[model samples]
Target: MTAELRGTWLYDAHVDLGTPIMVGPTPEGVRAIFPVTGGRLEGPRLKGRFLPHGGDWARIRGDGSIVLDVRALVEADDGALIHLTYGGRLVIPAEIQARVLDLANPDPLAGDRYYFRTLPLFETASPGHAWLNGICAVGVGRVVTGGVAYRVYAID
Candidate 1:
């Protein structure tokens, strides 16, 4: 049998970021640490703002792609604190990889220009929001002016 993705557009999390702390070259690749400043999370199932205490420690690959390792805390509107961590890949076109990492570019490329996909796993102790723990989500992300925004969906 073949598989299909009948997804429910669940929520969106617009994560803001501060300057990246460059870790220079490593055996694996170039490392950059991006701090989460503040952000807005809005959607039908999950709604809240991101707490300013998480970051992305991403390694830039040789082929213009990014291997993402991110962890963050989100506070739901109802006061529930959720912990989220995700590792994914972002494929950048070779033609624009340099400009994409140049921080000073001041412009975000259109979302359609690259492939930014993520699988996010969430955890929370709040009974009301425990459904997050049982769902597998697919996140389609884009680079925004000040941050990255993810439109998450649950596969049905």
Candidate 2:
């Protein structure tokens, strides 16, 4: 048996990251934390801004791919608060990473140049946007001028 995969646009979010706090080589790999300074969100199902209380705890693997461990809170335009967490992989060459991760660099790169994808999950107590609780989602990310923007889609 086979099941086809389908999806619907959920929201678009632009995440701003603060300076990274590098935790140098740990057993887990080269660790670092990119604070979630600010963000904005908008879409058909929901409209909101991401609270600046979370961050991305990324690790550089031996293969050079970075594991993205992100945590964030979303405040829907109506004031409903939702927790958004996602785990993913980002594969970028060291040279590019050095340039892009620098706060000094403001040039946006084309996402097709590297691999960046995320599996997002949402949780909330608000009745109006409760549909996000169980819906599996995927976010395709792009490197913006100073941050990363994602177009999230709900699996249907």
TM-score of each: 0.92, 0.95
What local distance difference test score does each model get? 0.88, 0.88
- lDDT string for model 1 (1-156, tens) is 988879899898899888999998899998999999989889988899999999999999876589999999999999999998888888889897666655445787878888999888899999999999888888999888678989998877
Model 1: residues with Cα > 4 Å off, grouped in runs: 102-106
* Tens-place lDDT digits, model 2, residues 58-128: 99888888999999998899999999999998888777876655654777667877889999999999999
For candidate 2, give the lDDT: 0.88
lDDT accuracy of residue 29 in candidate 1: 92
Best-fitting candidate, scored by TM-score: 2
